[model samples]
Target: MRKLSCLLTGLMLTAVPGVCMAQMTADTRLGVGHSVTDADLRAYFSIPPSGKGLPAGSGTALQGETVFTESCAACHGEQLQGNMAPGIGADKLIGGRGSLATNNPVKTTESYWPYATTLFDYVKRAMPFNAPGSLTDDQVYSVVAYILAQGKIIKADETLDATTLPKVKMPNRDGFIADPRPELSLYR
Candidate 1:
């Protein structure tokens, strides 16, 4: 019994170091995540309302209609009225102008969005229902131009790029008031 007790004690003490070494190796973070490269950061970078970080590409409303028909029409509908398919609820993109004051105000892009640049950023980040971030910069710009033109916000022939997109005024541009509280990184 004494020998058996010592033998068990010896095994436990021997096993403790091995377990500790395994934990220590895990803390080393070897074979974990790779360091973030410039390209990596650029891939998921945010586009501000000022049009900063917008990629270098140009697209017109005419070109945007084609892209929209192919990629966006499935969820957004042919006339951008949105699809309420079972679980999929796509938002409408136009109309609702001056309806914010009404009880039945529809919060479409033309009536709610404060900036055209924001529209471009949203399409760039997420769109096409199933395939998000798949559209090229030109496609994104064109789509924004088409939606804006459809909403009568801009001329159909107008081209939208980083510089021109920011300059395009939205109907509700002054609708939103700036936050009085100090900016916080978490909110951003």
Candidate 2:
């Protein structure tokens, strides 16, 4: 009787694993490999400086001003000077053209952004603070134009398109230098 009881217990334990495995196999229906569509993949990805993944929309500065006044002026200030509250602070987006070497430099769009593509890409990915990338292509273009104009880089009447945006020159275009660290040669 004792031997029979022990044999039954061992058989039950061994069968339990098999039963679980069989149930799992029956419940699941996944193939070896599957992927999302190209459009779905693009919805989540952002474009970067190398122009790796930009979208096809175009915008103009004239269109951007209306968008900026309606959406951005609250936090970024009416002139892009940045607003400061107790705990909430907005970034300054214009000026700081020649203050990079100063102790209290005011780094802004005029002095900081390396390329115009970067500005467009950044606005498209993140802007407006409360709601990011909510601007239309034309709105984006206009807001960029407004900021650039405030920075003294471009005129208010100037229209910005894909071709003209990249061509616009910033005052601090050559401000950034390539990294040369370690100081090994200097020490030697």
Candidate 3:
């Protein structure tokens, strides 16, 4: 019994170091995660309403139509209308101009979204439903232009880049009032 007890104690102590060393040699640091690089952080694609984070790219609504037809139409529908049919659910992209004041409001791109830059940001970051963040910046701009044009928010011929997209006003630009919550108040 005494020998067995020491043997068990010896085995446990031996196993403890082996388990500790195992993680050290496995290329992971304390099981936290891989070290992040600037590229990884930059990949988030968080473009503000100011269009500041927009990457270098250029495209027109005409070009966007092609990209949208190929990548977006499946989920968004043939007319950029929402897919509420059976199991296919997606938001409508155009034509809901005056519904905000109505009881049954249909908030589409033209009716609800305030900033054109946000449209580009959303498409660039989370779009095509199936493959998020797959489209290039140029394709994002084009798609934004196409959707805006369809809603008559922007001219069909207008080219949407970082510079112009922020400037293109939407119907709902003034829909949002300044958030006047007390906590957000400036120190007086």
Candidate 4:
């Protein structure tokens, strides 16, 4: 009787996993929201520097101004100067050009960000302090263009898309240097 009980328990454990695996591998489309299609998989992936995974849609600085005013102005000033209110310390996004040499260097988007693609990526992933991860791809591009244009990084007419976004040069593009420290730890 003990041997039979042990055998049944082992069989149940093995069979349960097999059944679960089969269900997971089987018609995933009919299951809960965990099942994802190719399109769904594509949406969550990050866009590379080369814009390999860039989603469709385009935006201009003009349209971006509206979006920024509506969603961003409450915190980052209407002019994109960042949130300076008491207790809120949002960084400025415009000026700081040619200030890196000074004792007090201002690191705004125009002055510090290395790549234009980073702006789009960051805005898409996080922004609008009150709410994060809410902006769409097109909105991010448009907001990036608006901020860049305001900072004099790019011309007003230049539209930021996957192709052109990578091309827009940033002032501090060459400011960053690779870390020289060894990655492996030798702590005591």
State every prediction's TM-score relative to the real structure: 0.77, 0.68, 0.76, 0.74
Alpha-carbon RMSD to native, per candidate: 14.2, 15.7, 13.6, 10.7
Q: Model 2, 14-47: lDDT tens per residue?
A: 3542232112222235555333344444445455
Candidate 3 backbone collisions, by pair = none
TM-score attained by model 4? 0.74
Clashes per candidate (backbone, < 3 Å): 0, 2, 0, 0
Model 3: per-residue Cα lDDT at residue 4: 46
Candidate 3 lDDT, 1-188, residue by residue in tens: 33443344334534553232212233464565544343444454366788776778888989999999999988888799877867657888888788999998988888898888777777877887788889988888888888888988889999988789889989999998887888766632
**Model 3 lDDT on a 0 to 1 scale:** 0.77
* Winner of 3 and 4 under lDDT: 3
Tell me which of candidates 1 and 4 scores higher on TM-score.
1
Worst 10 residues of 2 by lDDT: 18-27
Write one digit per residue (lDDT tens) for candidate 4, span 107-141.
88977888888778778877877777798878888
Model 2 steric clash pairs: 64-142, 64-143
lDDT of 1 by residue, 1-188 (tens): 33443344434534553232112222244666443343444454467678877789999999999999999888888999988787676878999999998999989999999988878888888887698889988899999999999999999999998789889889999988878776664552
lDDT for position 115 in model 3: 86
TM-score of candidate 2 to 2 decimals: 0.68
Ranking by lDDT: 1, 3, 4, 2
Residue 130, model 3, lDDT: 86
